[model samples]
Target: MENARRTTLADVARAAGTTVPTVSKVLGGRSDVSAGTRTRVMRVVAELGYRGRAGRAVPPDAGRPPFVDLVLSGIEGTWANRALSGVERAAADAGVEVVVSVTRPPDDAWLTRLLARRLRGAVLALVDTTPDQLATLAAARMPVVLLDPVRQPPGTVPSVGAANWAGGRAAAEHLLALGHRRLGVLAGQRTHLYSQARVDGFRSAVTQAGLDLADDRVVHTDWRRAPSRARAAELLRGADGPTAVFACSDAIALGVYDAAAELGLRIPQDLSVVGFDDLPEAEWATPALTTVHQPIAEMGGAALRMLLRLGTDQPPEAPREELATRLVVRGSTAAAP
Candidate 1:
């Protein structure tokens, strides 16, 4: 019996009447290739039953453990901890290790260091990755997935996040249902896409209810406890203070609690609060926080799964996957006084 020869990129290119470099470009997911050319090249690749070079296939052995890079903006808060836990759990299930990295500035040096590791892929959580950084990853043929990116990444990149808009609307509706017309929102940084969606959704709900959300009532603060606390203090101390506050994150909501304390306001009794991202702190708060339960851990796990798929040369089913968010009623909210 004769042995079948393994298919090669050159063979596929010749069959498609294209150059080897063109086939390589198409397989590399480069944007420079025209849509028609890409389709044609992929068709030829399929018809030839061409898999990439043997080195490209995922190793079947259990000898050396593979690692995926999990990059974050910072790893200091409950939100970060929850997300990291999810990613680590998923990675464990897949028998892969996670190398967690914090990209404060997300500079080229970080990319360089990551590339040096020769990781299988990378999952970036709450990190605002730049185009150049993405280009470097692409050049290295490394798959990348974004988890709650501060901004929408390029169309080619896959992302996992929560339904921030719906969560925001739910928060506003909950407060509105409690007969709280005067409301304030402690939003995260303006640059965060989720933060903007949340604010927009909240604003939409308020407008639909024929209520006005004044500009001053919507304060944008850093996504940290201390900064949010300071901003909340400003809102709470204002003469036209809000009777109810909707914080974009539980951390921010905690800040609201601090501000209320400084101003001698009691939770639910004096000031009603609603928060997003139902972190552990939400349940531990004095009055417990009524918050939108964003599946932070699920998002992390989903991103890791997507990265794994990409590592195997599989395109994601969707460019963006948004986990659902639900409102969890807790002890912090009450009817307006």
Candidate 2:
């Protein structure tokens, strides 16, 4: 008797004249559905009390295990992996499951997929979001937290990131302290908020030392290995090239290594290299890289905890949180040749 009265996903779909997946999407808080369809499906869900009829996500037979979505642009390399490890560890400790979703180009395919389930909140890692998308999530009463937002996100969107400017400054300071005057920069996308902050920080340190980045000295790349390698080769091969290079990421620093090997320039001896992010790869490199440590894993964990707090309607006093960064000296830097 009770089973007959239960409002299943199918029941809402039938009442709304849509498929179960569409109803699931609407209930899940996805932005892919048409306005009319979302409205109709939600109306049926309200009328039938779909959530109350059964339970969130799974059936009543199994206890409701709340979960959250960890959405990313891509989970390809060490940065993403470190972030994922942190989030997963946090979720494990909290006894909640995490659903990872990836999408590129900001199409919100990950969000669409997330909406098909009953999730408590979301953490967007290195993914951009639009106002329209935020409004859709708002309509669904979903809380979102950004992990290292591409730019300064709206005040309404809470975010967790490291102290990028400080890190960049520290990297430059280290190089300057080592007596390297002429320097090159391998920066990430110039338009990125953090990227700009880092560069500005490095520039600030350089300025304090009575130096500045030359027009041809700074090369902005897409933060990939092959392209960065090519760009570094060009920068190093130039006449009167910089004796030291500040790579925005450890990945980029590796490219500098490749370029040096190809150009017959020995690290620290001929070409000093410093990198950011202090990824494990930094220590594993042949000469061990000097770098700024951004606490990438901690940022990921912090974002998850913030998202959970938002889920419980307990937001932090500050919406934007930034962790600190520090410089770790290693074998890669030396006095200018």
Candidate 3:
């Protein structure tokens, strides 16, 4: 009775028009199935709500655990969560489970211990860890795909990152095109390669356009909400303030908005602002921020797929993927006052 009603391998086999042993092989995480058979079995398993795990090798039992484990460096903020959502969605479609963990201090020891367990592959969310930290993880011999990984080594590890430098240059050029010579840039932490690249690109654009970037015009702040607000306020209060501002991220741009409101300054009319990482909330900002849009969700999904492909000894399917970025002009930016 009740056991017969419950969905089982035999039921799935019947549903997919396959033999019991064939269904069992695919459900047991074997790669021997042809593409067509694997797809059929998975569709039936998903339809029947059959779940199996993947953290460790185990005899096939009802509802096995997930097979893939996901490692995340930082789990803070809406952006991180949204990106993880994309990865999780892809993993679920493949019948894989995802485990997310943060990489805290003493990076190597913590990472090594974490990776000692069985995992199909790993992904670093934003690559905030130090070079030494990356080297230690690479030595573990596990297939690793890094999102926004620094390009210092530029070796054969599958790296996926945004075209940040181009975005920064575009931001600067936009302000310049609007006749904004006195411009200020709100930069994120210098240690992060993404931030560094943005700063470099902005500086390069200023130089190329024959505009001077005064030392005081650029303010570097941690990618925190409060600190960016305070720093933006300090810069805005200066005697010779900028006519326009470029914030490295939307989070930092939010702080700038707060500071602007406190100072009774109007957007575009008084100061034009541009931001990076056109997050979902960017359009909803008070004046609707003008920003550089990065494909955060797509990047997450692609990184996960690349790692999964590494499960076998296949050739690199699309190594070193660099997604492009574009500038979205909106109410927040206008001709300098």
Model 1: worst 10 consecutive residues (lDDT sum): 53-62
In angstroms, what RMSD does candidate 2 have relative to the true structure? 7.8
Q: Residues 1-337, candidate 3, lDDT per residue (tens digit)?
A: 3555566668778998999888766644455667577667666765665533233233224677545555566677767887788788888877887888776654333354444545666777765555434433332334577887744433656767889999999999999989998899899987778888888888899999988898788899988768999999988886678879899999899899999999988897988889999987789998999999988888888788878777423233438777899999989999877
lDDT: worst 10-residue window of model 3: 51-60
lDDT of 2 by residue, 190-288 (tens): 888888888889999999999978868888987787889999999999658999999999999999999999999999999999998898999999999
Candidate 1, 1-337: lDDT as tens digits? 9899887778978887889898776655456667667556656655665656535534434678888999888888788898999999999999999998887572334555565565788898888876645644553456789999889787777899999999999999999999999999999988889999999999999999999999999999987788888899999886669999999999899999999998999999889999999988999999999999999999999999888877545353537899999999999999998
Quote model 2's TM-score: 0.81
Clashes of each: 0, 1, 8
Every candidate's lDDT: 0.83, 0.81, 0.75
**lDDT of the structure predicted as candidate 3:** 0.75
Cα displacement (Å) at residue 204, model 2: 0.5
Error of 3 at 185 (Å): 0.6
Ranking by TM-score: 2, 1, 3
Which of 1 and 2 is ahead in lDDT?
A: 1
Cα TM-score per model? 0.80, 0.81, 0.74
